[model samples]
Target: MNLKETQKKFHKTLSEIYPKSEIDTFFYWIVEDVLQLKRIDVSLNPDFEINEKDLKTIKSQMNRLQQNEPIQYILGHTEFYGMHFQVNPNVLIPRPETEDLVNWIVSDLKHQPKKHLLDIGTGSGRIAIALKKELPKCEISAFDISETALQMASENAKQNEVKINFVQQDILKLDSLPEDVDIMVSNPPYVRVLEKEQMCDNVLKFEPHQALFVKNNDALVFYRKIIELAITSSKCKTVYFEINQYLKEDLKKLIQPYDINKIEFRKDFRGNERMLKLLID
Candidate 1:
């Protein structure tokens, strides 16, 4: 079918599952992914025909989308910090809010002399890869509990042509590191398991649960563990986390006794307190 016809059909299919705005975005992304053509190209070349094989593949992808599978996973890649990274069920798909966390950390690092940076739970290696790309002189280490995730992160580092020490280590059991880090960052499992009832099927069903949810009784378990590690094991001057919006005040209170230089809570595009940057004293 022609470009316009294909888009119309795709929009209709997606709108059945998601809002019109999201459906439009999915339509544009699917077209771009399959045709290697931008929206303007589709407009200027309305008669562009997709081959039968490509149409079938696109339709299959749409079916997955309808089932609430993230488009990044469906496409097998996602753009983060202006670079493409491979994503799959083995790793949690990167989010725009996490991009904000990365930007905040990178902005702070720009003024400081280069030093070691560590990313805990480096799923898909998005944050570490982006930091390594932007701050080429800085030493970087990334750790993940999942063997699958670390392998994907290693591949991502190779793909980005950036050298990062990818370690398969659980933060809960980490010992002393090889060197003192200047900064540490993590977007750990802040979503409590009890919160699953409120989460969308796109997340709860398709994303890796171990990377997303913590035990209900201890919503801040990962936070507590990582912060303790940062204070004891890491030589970093600063630490950061992508936080759950509901636990902003609680998190600040939890870490106050540790003598953190500044515990700043920043809002995301949605105006929710979604990131916390803690400067370690």
Candidate 2:
């Protein structure tokens, strides 16, 4: 089929499941991934032909898309912090809100002395790798509970040409971190299990559960553990977390007892208080 015809069919199928605008973007991304053509090229050459084999593969992906499968999972990559990251079901797809957290950390480091940074619960090593790329002089280490996730993170570190010490250790254990870490950052599993009912079926069904859900009653388990660990084990200059939007006030109160220098609640692009930057002297 011609590129235009294929995209038309794909959009119609996807629009039945998702909004038309989103489906159009999805169609563009799929065509780009399969054909290695830019969006402008697709537009300029709408009559570009698709081989039967290639057409079959694209059709299979369309079927998955219609089933509400995420486009990132289909394409096996995502763009974050101006870099492409390999993604899969083993790790949570990096979100734009997390990019704000990365930018905040990088901006704060501009005036501070270069020191070691540790990324706890570093799934796919997105934050750690991004920080290391931007601040090449800083020492970086990242830890994840899932071996598969750590492998992906390690690969990403290599892909980004940033050296990160990727360790497969649970942050809850808090046993593997080094002393005198100047900064500790984490985007942990803060989504309470009970909140799964509210999540889209695509997310709940496809994404890794271990990377997304914490116990309902112990929703702040990761934050509490990481905070305690930072207090006792880190001589860190700062601690940052991409927090759950609903718990901003509660998180602020939770960290009040500590010797925090500044607890800045920053909003994401959508203006939701999605990240907390804590400076500890």
Candidate 3:
């Protein structure tokens, strides 16, 4: 069928699940990814006919979308920090707010001498690889407890053409931070179980839960461990985290015991407290 007709049916099938604008985005994203046609092409060629095989593929993806699967996972890739990274159920999809956290680190370290950076719980390796791309002289190492996540992260690093040391280790069990790491960054699981009602099904149902949630009573578990490790690291000078907006005060109290010289919180585009910077003394 024609692109316009297919999109109309797509919208109809998903109207009960997603809003009109989101359906439009999902349709166009699939078109661009599967059909190799740009949005403008679809607009100018409204009658553009999709082949039967491709149509079946598009319909299959629409079914998954109807089931509340994230489009990124359906497409097997996503764009972050101006680069594309492969994604799957193994890692959480990188969010735009996390880009702000990456920007904060890049802005501060861009002119500094070469430093080693470690990304704890580096899911898809978005933060570490982006930093290495922007600051080529810097060495980067990323570790996650899930071997599948580490494999995906390693592939993403290769796809981005950046060299990053990918390791498999649970952050909660690590004894010490890497000796040469000068800066550490993470967007670890900070969502409390109680907050699940506030999230969308596409996230809660499709994204890896272990990479997005913590126990309700211990929302700061990862932060607590990382901060304790960072403060004791001889070469680590600074740390950055993409945090949950609701836990800013809790995070503040959690960091109070660390030998920190400065602590700053930056809001994301939505004006929520989402990023944190800690300069270790």
Candidate 4:
């Protein structure tokens, strides 16, 4: 069938599962990835025909999307911080809010001298790699419990042409970082188990749970450990976290006993308290 016919069939088949706008997005993304045609090309060349092999691949991806799989996983890559990143089930897809977190770090440290930075639970290496790209003079290291995630992060680092020291170590078990750093940043698993219902099926079904969830009673477990480690590590001058909005007060209480120079909370585009920065003296 032609591209227009394929588009209609794709929308009709998945209409119940996704909205028209989302379906349109998925269609264009698939078209560009599979057919090597831009969205404007599709509109300009309405009669464009996709070959049989390409048609089969498109249908297979549609089947997966019908099952609520994320388009990022289907495409095997996603745009984050204006760069392309490879993603899979082993690593969480990078989100726009995390971009805000990265910008926050860049704004704070851009004028400072070269320093070391550590990204805890750096799945897909988005935060670490982006910072390395932004602050080319700084040394960056990232660690994760999952070997597969670290592997993908390493690949992404290489793809982005940014060097990052990727290590496989669980933050929960680390009493201190392996290396001293001026900035310690993490967008750890802050989603509580009870909040699963609020997430869409695409995320719950396809994304790695290890990178997205925390127990209800210990929602801030990763934060707690990372903070303790940062506070104890003399060289870690600052700590950054992409946090759950509901637990802002809890996070403040968690850091209450620590010696900190300043604490700032910033909201995402949604106006939710999604980023936190703590300056440790």
Candidate 5:
């Protein structure tokens, strides 16, 4: 079938579940990824025929999309901070705000001396890998409790041509990390049980919830533990986190006992204060 005709069917199959804008995006992304057909090319040549195998692949992808699977997971990879990462159900797909958190650190450290950076609960190793790629001189290592996530991250590091040391350890049970890193970065599980209703099925049903939520009554569990590690380890000079949007003031107060007014928060593109940069005094 030709590209334009198939795209019409694609929109029809998915419009009931997703908006037309999203379906159009899916059509363009799959075409680019699979057929190497740029959007402009598709627009200029509406009758561009997709080969048989490609048509079959698109059908399969359409089915998955209809099932509410994320397009990134369906493609088995995603772009973050201009780098491509391998993603799966085992790891949460990296989000744009997390990219902002990464850029915040990279921009701050780009002109400075190389620092050792540790990423806690580094599912898919998005933060650590992006930092390493941007700041090549900096040493990067990441930790995750799930062996599956660590494996996926390791593959992404290899694919990105950046070497990152990935370790398996639960943040809640850490006595200390492998070595003293100068920077700690995390986008840990801060979602409360109550927030699930606010999330989409692609997230609640497909993404790894172990990396998304804490107990409803204890949404700050990972933050508290990591901050304690920062104090006790006395190694991390600064820590960056992509936090739950609703918990900004609570996070500020939670870290205040350690060092009052040492924390600064960054807003994402949407103006929610979703990124926190905590400095140890």
Candidate 6:
């Protein structure tokens, strides 16, 4: 199949499940990965021929996407905060909102002295790895409960040429992090179980549920535990979290014990409160 033929097939087949805009994104992502070509190449050489083996692989991936698999998983990796990460069914694909959380932390610490960093429930090590890339002098450690997820995260760290200590420990059970950790970040499982209906079939079917969900009645469970640990640990000067968009007021009340002036809720570009920054005395 030629480039034009492959493009036509992708549009025709994927349009059944994804919108035209999303289909364009999926096509470009697959083209760059499979063909070692840029988006410009699709138009520059519409007649370029795809080898038989590569065509078969592309068609196989199209079949998977047709079956509701995420294109990131089909590609076996994804980009986050300008860095690529190896992903699988064991970890949740890093989202743009989480990138924002990472940016907030990096912006605040980019010029500061070296500090110890800890990321809880660091699926795919996206946050931890990105932080290490941006803050090369900082010591970074990331933990996840799943060995499969931790393995994928370690691979990503190596591929990115960043050093991150990946640990297989459940955040729900771990009461404290290492001392001297001046900054702590977590994008824990904050999506409530009841909110599953609001998600797309591809995410619900393909993403790792353990990394995406928390109990409906206890939506802030992870936040609560992590904050308590930060407070008790006494070494965490600042805490950053990718929070549930719907729990703004609940989070404000939950952290009441901390100085209100130091607790700030930041909204995502969508205008919902999606992150929190807490400074401890």
Candidate 3 lDDT over 1-281, as tens digits, reads: 99999999998999999999999999999999999999999999999899999999999999999899999999999999999999999999999988988888889989999989999999999998999999999999898999999999999999989999998999999899878888889899999999999999989888999998999999999999888888899888788998998899899898887789999999998899999999988
Local distance difference test values of all predictions, in order: 0.86, 0.86, 0.92, 0.92, 0.89, 0.88
Off by over 4 Å in 6: 258-261
Query: Can you write out model 4's per-residue Cα lDDT over 1-281, one digit (the tens) per residue?
Result: 99889999998999999999999999999999999999999999888988899999999999999999999999999999999999999999999999999999899889999989999999999999999999999999998999999999999999999999998898898877755677889999989999999989999999999999999999989988888888788688788999999999999998888888899999998899999999888
Q: In the order shown, what is each candidate's alpha-carbon RMSD? A: 1.8, 1.4, 1.0, 1.0, 1.4, 1.5
Report model 1's TM-score to 2 decimal places. Answer: 0.93
Which residue ranges in model 4 land beyond 4 Å of their true spot?
none
Q: Please give each candidate's TM-score.
A: 0.93, 0.96, 0.98, 0.98, 0.96, 0.95
Q: What does candidate 3 score in Cα RMSD to the true structure?
A: 1.0
Q: Summarize candidate 1's per-residue lDDT along 1-281 as a digit string, tens digits.
A: 88888878878887768998888788789888887889888889989999998889888998999899998889989888898899999999988888888888888877788789989999999999999998888999999999999889988899989999998988888765555776788999888777889989888889999998887778888788777777775476678889999888789779978967787889988898999888777
* Candidate 1 lDDT trough over 10 residues, lowest sum: 174-183
How accurate locally is residue 238 in candidate 3, as Cα lDDT from 0 to 100?
A: 87
- The global Cα lDDT (0 to 1) of model 4 is 0.92
Q: Determine which window of 10 residues in candidate 5 has minimal summed lDDT.
A: 252-261
Ranking by lDDT: 3, 4, 5, 6, 1, 2
After aligning candidate 2 to the native by TM-score, how far in Å is the CA of 47 from where it should be? Answer: 1.8
- Worst-scoring 10-residue span by lDDT in model 2: 171-180
Clashing residue pairs, backbone N/CA/C < 3 A, model 1? none
lDDT of 5 by residue, 94-182 (tens): 88888889889989999999899999999999899999989999999899999999999999999999999999998898887555689
The lDDT of model 5 is 0.89
Off by over 4 Å in 1: none
